[model samples]
Target: MIVAAWTVCAGTVMPAAADTDPRGYLTKMKAQEMWKVADGTGITVAVIDSGVKDIPGLEGRVLPGMSFMEPPFERPDVSYPPHEDFVGHGTTMTAGIVGDGSAGGPRGLAPGAKVLPIRTSVGTPMAFAVASEAAKGIRYAADNGAKVINLSIGMTQDWPMGKIKPAVEYAQSKGVLIFAAMGNEGEGNNWTNVIAALPGVLGVGAVDEDGQVMPFSSHGPDTDLSAPGGQVLNRCNGNKDWCVGDGGTSYATSLASASAALVWSAHPDWTANQVARVLIQTAGGPVDGAKRSDWVGYGAVRPRKVLLDHEGDPGVPDADPLASPAPAKAPTPSAEQTAAAPRRVESADAESGLSWQWPALGAVVALSLGITVLVKRRRR
Candidate 1:
C-alpha cells in the first residue's frame, strides 16, 4: 500500500547561543492575559506529522495515536506510546501546542490542552509514503475525538484534491477545526497548497517578533490568519535544551491550532463555526475596505481578543466562515470537473538562507530530504 505522494519537509531548526525565554511568543501575543480567562483547559489537538516524543515538557499531556507509516521503516514502532519524534519536527510542534513548562522547558499557548500524536511521516526519507496516508490520518483523528487537527506539513503541489476533500469534509462535519501551513515559499509562488486552500481549513502564515509577515511565509487568498513563527523557540528531540531561530508556517499552524483550543476551551458550547468566525472577525489585520490581505490573511491571530473580550458578534453558529457558494445540484458529475488537475507551480525550500532542489513533478510524488538544521552554540 505504498501510494506515490509528495515528501514532507521537516521544520527548520537553528541552534542558538543562549536559551530564549520560552514564553517569548506568549508574551508578544498577549497570551498571558487570556490565560486568566482560559488556558485551553479542555481541548485536544491532533499533531499530524512525525511522531511526538514524551519529553519532560510534554509529560501527561500527550495521548496515544496511530502511526500510518509502514513497518521496518525509519520509524517502525506503531503502538500505544506513539511518542518517537524521528526528525524533532513533530515534537517541537507538540510542545508548541500543549507544553506546560513542567520541566522548566518551553511553555505552549494551550498548556492545558492534550495532544493526540498521529505519526504520519518518518522524517523526509519517507515523506512521500507518509503523505499518501495523510487523509486517512485526518479521518482517524476526527473519529477518535480531536477537537482541532494541526497539519503543519505542506507541499508545493496540491495533493489530488479528490483524495483529500472528503477527508477534510469529514473532519469538519465532526466539529473539528483544521489548520495547515501555507508553505514556506513566499519568495517564490507562495501558492497555498490544496490542503490549506480547502474551504473549511484555516490556512496560517508566519509572522516575526515585530509583528511583520516573514518574507518566507506563503501568501494567497486562501490564507486565514498569521501567527508568531519566525525565530520562535521550541524543544528538540533527545535534548532538554530548547532550540531557537525556528521559522516556517509549520510553527505558525501549531500556534494557531493552540489558539483555537484556547477559545474552544473557554467557550465549549460554541460550535466550530462560531469559533472560526470569532477568530477571523477579531484578528488583527489591515482594513482594506473590510477585506483581508492575501499576504497576512485576515490578520495576525489574537486569541486574547476572543477570550478576554466577550462583546463581539460571532455570526452564525453553524455557518462556515470560508464556505463558497454552492453549485447547482446535479445528478451526475461533469467531465471537466472530474478530470481537471489543480493549477500548480514548483518551488524550493529557502529556510535559513539555504536552498535545496525538490523532487520533480510526476504521477509519483517525492519530497526532498534537505531539512536544514544549523548547529550553533547550544542553549540550555
Candidate 2:
C-alpha cells in the first residue's frame, strides 16, 4: 500500500510575456531556425493524459482517440470525450506539442504535427489503474500509427513487471519512441519514476532558461535528457488560457516528444533507433564534459544541432542507443527497502486554474542555489 502522502508542489508562474514569441522553450531550443527546415509534418504524437480539448489553437489537428476513464476500465459515471479535458493538464501538454497559436495560445514547437488524444486519469489517487491504462495506451498508440508516444504522467510506485515493461518493449519493437516524465519529486521526495526508468524509454528532466536543472525535476541514471520546462507558456483549461507551466517534468517530457517529432519528420525513412541515437548524440552534454550524468543525463536536448547545423549522424537503424545490457536475475527487495520506498509522488501535470503573473525572480534564485549544493553532492 502507498505510505507517503500525495503531494503536488506549487510552481512559481512566469507569464508568456509579449516579447517571448512561440514561448520561451521554443526560443531556447532555437526552434524557429529549425522550423525553416521541418515543422513536425507527417508525424503523429500520442498524448496519453487527462484528455484534450479541441481548442482554437488545435483546430483540425486533434484526432478522435479512445478513452480509458470509464465503463470497463473505470467508473461508468466518469465518462468523457477524448477531446474533452478533465483538468486542463492534458490540453496544456497537447498545446505544447501541436498548438498553432491561432487562439492566442503559445504556438507549439512542432505545429505541423498532429495529436492523438488518449484520455486517462493522471491524478494521484488512482495509481494502479493509471499504470494499467498507461501500458495499454502505449500499445494502442504503437498499433494505431503514432510515430511517438508522450506520457506526461508518472507514478512513484512500481506496478507488476509484466504490465508496463512488456508494453514498452512492444512499442519499441514497433519503432515507436516513448517519452515519459521523470517526475517532480526533486530532492525531498526523490521517488524512482516507474515508466521513465524502463528500457528504451527516454526519461526526460526539466531545465530552465539559464540551463540549470529545475529543483523539482527528479534526477537519476534514468534521466536521458533535459528540456526547457521553466517559464513555459501554454493554454490551460477553457476558462484560463495562457498560463505558464514552470518547473514540472510533464511539460519537459512533452517538449521532448515534440523534439522527436521534429527529428522524425525531417527524416521519414529513419527508424526509431536512428532518431533516438541522433537525439542523444546531438544533446549538449554535462558542463564537466562527462558523457553522461545522473542529473541531466546526457544534458539538455539541443535538436537545433541536428536540424540547423546538420550535426548528428543517424547511426545504425536497428541499434538502440538507450538499450542497456540484460541484467542478471536479482533477489527480491527486502521488507525494509520496500517500506522505505516513496509511494505517491504526484504526476507531473501543470497546475489548473492558475492566475497569470510575472516571473518569480526570487524562486529562480532559490532554484539556482538548490542546484549548486545538489551538484556538489552529486559529484562526490
The true-versus-predicted C-alpha distance at residue 150 of model 2, in Å, is 0.6
lDDT of 1 at 246: 44
Give the per-residue lDDT of model 1 (tens digit) for 111-147. 8899998886435445565555678888999999899
Task: List clashing residue pairs in candidate 1.
Answer: 7-367
Give the top-scoring candidate (lDDT): 2
lDDT of 1: 0.66
> How many backbone clashes does every candidate have?
1, 0
Q: How far off is residue 189 in model 2, in Å?
A: 1.8
Which 10-residue span in candidate 1 carries the lowest summed lDDT?
A: 330-339
Identify the runs in model 2 with alpha carbons over 4 angstroms from their true place: 1-11, 14-22, 71-78, 124-128, 234-239, 324-380
